[model samples]
Target chain A: MTAPAAVLDSPLRELSYAEAIRDALAIALAEDERVVLMGEDIGVYGGAFQVSGDLVHRFGEERVIDTPISELGGAGMAVGAALTGLRPIYEFQFSDFATLAMEQIVNQAAKLRFMLGGAVSVPLVMRFPAGSGTGAAAQHSQSLEAWFGHVPGLKVVQAATPYDAKGLLLAALDDPDPVMLFEHKLLYKTKGPVPEGRYTVPIGKAEVCRTGSNVTIVATAIMVHRALEAAEVLAQEGIDAEVIDLRTVRPMDRETVVASVAKTSRLVVAYEGVRTLGIGAEVSASIVESEAFDYLDAPIVRLGGAEAPIPYNPELEKAAVPQVADILSAVRGVVRGTR
Target chain B: MSISSETERCGAQAPAPGRKGSGGSARPASRRAGKTSAGNEPFAVRHYSPEVLREALRKMLLIRRFEEGAEDSYMRGLIHGTMHLSIGQEASAVGACLELTDQDKITSTHRGHGHCIAKGADVGRMFAEFFGKESGYCRGRGGSMHIADVDKGNLGANGIVGGGIPIAVGAALSAKRLKTGTVVTSFFGDGAVNEGSFHESLNMAAIWKLPVIFICENNHYGMSTSVERSTAVRQVSDRAAAYSMPGVTVDGNDLSAVAEACHGAIERARAGEGPSLIESVTYRWRGHSKSDRNRYRSKDEIDAWIARDPIRRFAGLLSEHGILSEEGFARMETEVAEQIAAAIAFAKESPDPDTAALTRDVYTTQTESVG
Candidate 1:
């Protein structure tokens, strides 16, 4: 597969990664009356990160509501709106702050439809800016995608590029169940070629960013970029390692994973969340429990953050999360096998 | 601590049942007249007409009976989940809910049967929920604590102590944004007033002027801890002033008083005056939950609050006004009993949810395949 030949032919503009999100929001709101952006400080304050810059001014306050610092209240309100025939795109100021609203997300909004016996659908999207940066410390910096993926009813997506951000967001709005979109705080300034017109990427499919045969490196969120960098380093050593972005974590792209395992016979799962019960666990367990187990010549390797709480100190925080160097070493170890 | 203070005659000295001086040893109507005349004049109360009063009485009795029946089932080992009975505090739920329009919404507490009946949930479906049948409001997945019907404006009963407060405020926020003209009433016990969500929600509602009524049913105890011990301020309503909103305390045992207080707050909220808090002073006749032994209180105290029983008091007023005779009371009881029995029968006959449906409503995916 030669990568679908860049379906978007428009000249790529030099927009910040955050501008791409705003552009995506502008397009969605301009195209559909049902789409609305809601969050704390997103309106008059242009979002805490300014991702929704000028959206309230552009779409008016009715469409872009600046909510109080009540995550649970705002999330529940979004759930109510979504239930009442509206597509509500909710923003948590920071992903770490999402813990305050867990009751609404995990208990009510996530389970309402299923509890109602298929009679209702919560067509809602909750976007949380995740990962460590800007010295936000323990309460703000967390790669918590695994916590949401652990849930049964929610679809969790982490888009690495600007194109995936726009496409994944649109797809999330189109999804009937609640979709959790984890946007990395560090990736907001990075930009890429995003389609100008409306386009959607299927939610539960994984994109193999690079193809190789020596080893399979699966990563998510910021770790996807790190894995890509590691893939280049491994290739320089004549070790062709395949890199797969497990974009959607809940209904995981197991077929792509199994296929990669069959080709390489070595697997390395990387994530930024804690090591235990993280996406790595799910990916590793899936391979062992499936037909892919027979094709694996070596044991599957898993790499993730430490189990301790995210530290405020910059050095400890860096040590807690996986880096490009970590990915390179993990990939090499998997390729070299038990030695 | 003399009982002869001018405020004492106005029912202000009516200690919670089973508390100190809670026995009905106080002098009769003679003392009540003197107390009520001096201190009660300032607190405006709306009186219901004889016919209207009788109907409200009927509703309260229905809630009491329904809960008692649920307790019976729980004791017999028929119900799978824990049951929280609103036995003593029926008037607060029934009285306040009666003031709401059909389109008005409410978020309920764990002890929610009273709110469900007052908000017009189908008794059969409520019974079905207790029975764990597929025909229940939540299709058996929500059991008791999560029974919800969006159509009926009953958002749902929550299991968390102050969980429903934020949700109800959210619904009110939606109503304000959508111009739905629907005001939400969030019912929680006095204990929930101490929760951070309670303050957060009230502050938000006040700032936005959202159409919501925060109804705190001060049933004296929050699962065995008295409100006085848990809170420094005497009444939960006083906290409303912190948000710059009006606060009122009403006699929860009086159905007319509760209805009027809630009615005023709802009207003000709909008029865009923002949210208000109404602290209804009531008692929970039963323990916090079905399994609680209620060793914290005395028998005499329970007997004291029983003297101010909402249903009986309202019924007495109705009879005194010639609105209901002995025959009418008998007829109402018979009708209530028959209705409850029919609901039980309907729930029993209703089939259990298919085992395959266990994974059905978990998500909105088109894949009919099971997880």
Candidate 2:
């Protein structure tokens, strides 16, 4: 299936991924009085990645709150605020720092509504600046979206393009449940055409970035762009590789992957997290567990991060995660039925 | 030493009950006096009307009886999971919530049955939750530790020791931002005072000038660990000074004293003066939960706390003040007992949740349904 073309009501403007996110925050704050932004260094600091640039100035300090260096307390505060009447968007300085606030995110925010027998819904959104590329070492650089996706009652999404970054964020605000948005750091400066007005991209749906028939390449976050690059290389070699960008991780778009796999007769699941128990495993299991299992022409290939922390050295950092070359080779192997 | 002996020492130092018609006033009295003495009137007796005092006594009795009934059911093997009984610490819960209305929010700890009752939760629904029935407060999804009545401003009780502290601060933030005029009270045990969340929440609430009251129910122990062993400060309230908030330590078993301390803190919060910490020094007669074997304390200590039961002390004080007659006290006890019995019967007759609808509340959208 092809990606849905958004209706062009307004002129398209070029926006970096970070600018698009800031635009969404500004829009949310302007439209709803309940929307509040909370994080460390978010106010005046323009956020760690400048994704919330100039929002504090435009919305005031009360709305773009700068919380203390208390991740557990700050996250729980967002949960509490969301539980009440406020719609809070909490940003973790770095996705790796989410380890400090796992209790509130997992135990409280993820299970509060279900535990309370649906008495209340947590309309909370958490922004995580994730993935490795810059010299952030092991602690600062990590793709932890799969960790959040494993939990129920949480909507986890990764917006590869600037268009989806703003659209998915707006959609997450409309959601009643807690949504964890993982914005890749490398994609922050990447510019794309985005709508000028408010728009929403449906969550829990995967978009077909490229169409082919030899093999289906399922990718997430930064890997989506890498798989698209690999698809171009594969097409030159007479390998028609279909690329599916999985937008949401928790409520995964399994139908698109399954239908694509059934047509291509091969699968290559690419993700930035570790290979074992990562989203790739879920995608692979979803296809094998479905009727698409009968259409497999060869064993499914998984292109994932190496079983080690993201190193400080540039070369090791690049080696730690799957690159376009790795996706190209993995897709080639799956299409050619080679071990 | 032992927390019970420390609690006993504090109990011995408490002032004698005030005489009737000595200092009773309809207007709200200043709590600057801190501790009531023989010359000064007891805070509740001096501040509240006879009707409010009578209702306070009734709620105190109801808390004690409800825990007793719950214990009875647990012993009879009717209830499944273990429960944290607030049997002896009823005064702290009832007194702290005495001035709260439906608009005010409260976050409770593991031993939160008293808080739930004090916050006006239905006893039948609470019991039904314990029985894992469909008609319970959480519809049987949240059992004893997570019971909540959002409409009554009772955020659900937390299983983690210090989990609810930050949540209460957030609620207060909401109240201040939305101009709801609602004050939030966070209730936790002595153990929670040492948690990082406690200190962080206190600091945030102070800086934000949020309308929140931190009520530390110093039951002397967080499970098996005593306050003296766990906490560095002399009293839990002393830590509030770090956050630039007024801190007070009161005899938690004394209903009037606990009520008086909380009244001041609640007033301070409502006025947007920022958060205040009140450490209610009390003891639990029962072991921490159903699994406790009383290895931490002695039988003598338990008996001493039982003798200083909050319900008995409050009833005796009410009787001395001519607010409740001995006959009226007995009638109240009988009535509370009947209510508990009826609640249990309702729970027994209530239907269990259907297995097919197990994942009904996982998400509001119901996009992907699977248990």
Candidate 3:
């Protein structure tokens, strides 16, 4: 029998982003009885994507409730439990399924606080494995963070690394407003250091994964990791590329991005969401709106998924979302003729 | 109660016409005291206990006072948002809630002040909610439509029409699975029965045998459309037969009858009897919200239903039972008036929530957060 993975390792131990998220949830549930997980096939089935693998055995069905295939129902149930003082961590089988529960998330959960004259809150965290990489096609693959980010009463976050996946989820579970945590399906296998003990990565705070003086590259979810890879390739070409992981999309850490752009003097925003009105557009506009635009060495570049439905074909799906090569090209183009 | 010249209210006394009964009887004029322009009438009465009778009267009066006060504040522009008043259908809320233990939970609708009060929420906090003050149950984050006092087992007053049904089903599932012996009662309107959530939740609850009581307050209209126009079966209770649950129609205006029906269902549920459906035939005295000037019904219909006022009927029963004399009933009314007056004063005097609190409780901090 394979023994369970070690938990006492240093915070930097290599682990898949999905494992890291599971670790974070385990630590959270172990620490508090109020924290419970609810979603379709999250328990006995070990999650459709296995993000909640082995949780049912550890927490039991009570803590890790396996619900019916009712997205709106599950979302509404989460809102109810949250309002009743339970910290509910709800999971959407896929980000695309979130559309079915939009009324609960957007109308009921999101607007509850504001409409109630700011009297009550929905202390709920909903995790949706988002973005296109797996040939899950249009219904299952869509980076719809912009849809949730546009809602005023909801906090939206996306995790690119094993570290942020674990930490941001922990943070989202703590927030009183409904929080939508977008996890890139492809990033699950990627490992990074995740602290063993309970800790939270603050929401709405951007992480500067790699520092450079040439160009500020702001990216979200899987795009953050791709940007980091592009930054590494850019470094070899004598082009210093700074990568900003937009861990939280709503109540975005604009200050961090603006400060980075002020130092780097060039900005490139990237995301897996569609190009039009996506997180990329929001970040680019923020840069132009801020005092940092005066220091821009070139026009702020925005790179995002093609403005089309995610295709079923593998090659088309790969081309739809920004890849390392695309980021590298975009960054190299921005840094060109600057010197 | 005496009307004061200082207060200018929206509704004026008008004789309602064409108010037909479920069985096609001519509506009584006295029952139409304050029916909104929608010619809806109060349903027939059920059995009443002496104590239950008084309790229902008090609660309904409380709702009436609360709504009257809310409308006053709303007209004055002191209340910021829209207020949905359950002025005429208090018996349904109180009667159903009476069957619930403190452990049992209720999911309310957008027009939910009556549900909150019946579920035992503090009147002061409810008032503070409308005032958008910090003392409100949600600390000003949740207003009237979202008031939730978990301690009182009121899940919340939902803003979306059919939103709370699923939550109640989940809570019922939790209760049954956890063996908590706590049933969940979901209060929605006839309008909500048409929602996809209503059907989905009912099917899930039935299949799971989750302990839930789906109380549809068929108050004759969903916003403006009459139940007759929307539903082929005039009696909303008939839908319960579709889910294979015992469907019973109760006089929502008669407090005792509602309590008896709910008590049987609640007891059966606690004993693992699965779920039941109770369609409370009722009417609304006010418009859907404070802003509505209901033009759907005639003056005769409005005047007719007011005559069958639940509060007045319950008071009459108490007098007939010799539980309380006319003077004693008057004293109860006076006490309720004073209590409500104090609640209003308390809300008026309560401090507003600090602006910084707007960001707090959105997430539980490690130092201050939940998880």
lDDT of 2 by residue, A100-189 (tens): 988889988998898888999999999999999999999999999999998998999999999999999999999999999999999999
Candidate 2: stretches off by over 4 Å = A1-7, B1-34
Model 3 lDDT tens row, A1-339: 011245334445778899999998998899888788989899978998899999999989888988878888888777877765578899999989999889888888877655555445678899998888889899999988899988777788888888778878877776667788988888888888776765678888889989999999998877887888888889899999889988888878888999999999999899988898878788888888889989998887788889799999999989998889888887877789542
Best lDDT among the predictions, by candidate number = 2
Q: What is the lDDT of candidate 1?
A: 0.79
Rank order (by TM-score, best first): 2, 1, 3
Error of 3 at B306 (Å): 2.8
Scored against the native two-chain complex, candidate 2 gets a DockQ of 0.70
lDDT of each: 0.79, 0.86, 0.77
Categorize the docking of model 2. Answer: medium
lDDT for residue A46 in candidate 3, whole number 0-100: 93
Candidate 1 residue lDDT tens string, A2-121: 123464565666666688788878988999887778899998889988899998888998889888788877787787667655688999999988998898788878887776556568
Q: Which of 1 and 3 is the better model by TM-score?
A: 1
Candidate 1 regions with alpha-carbon error over 4 angstroms: A1-14, A31-36, A80-86, A116-120, A311-316, B1-54, B366-371
**What proportion of the true contacts does each candidate reproduce?**
0.43, 0.67, 0.35
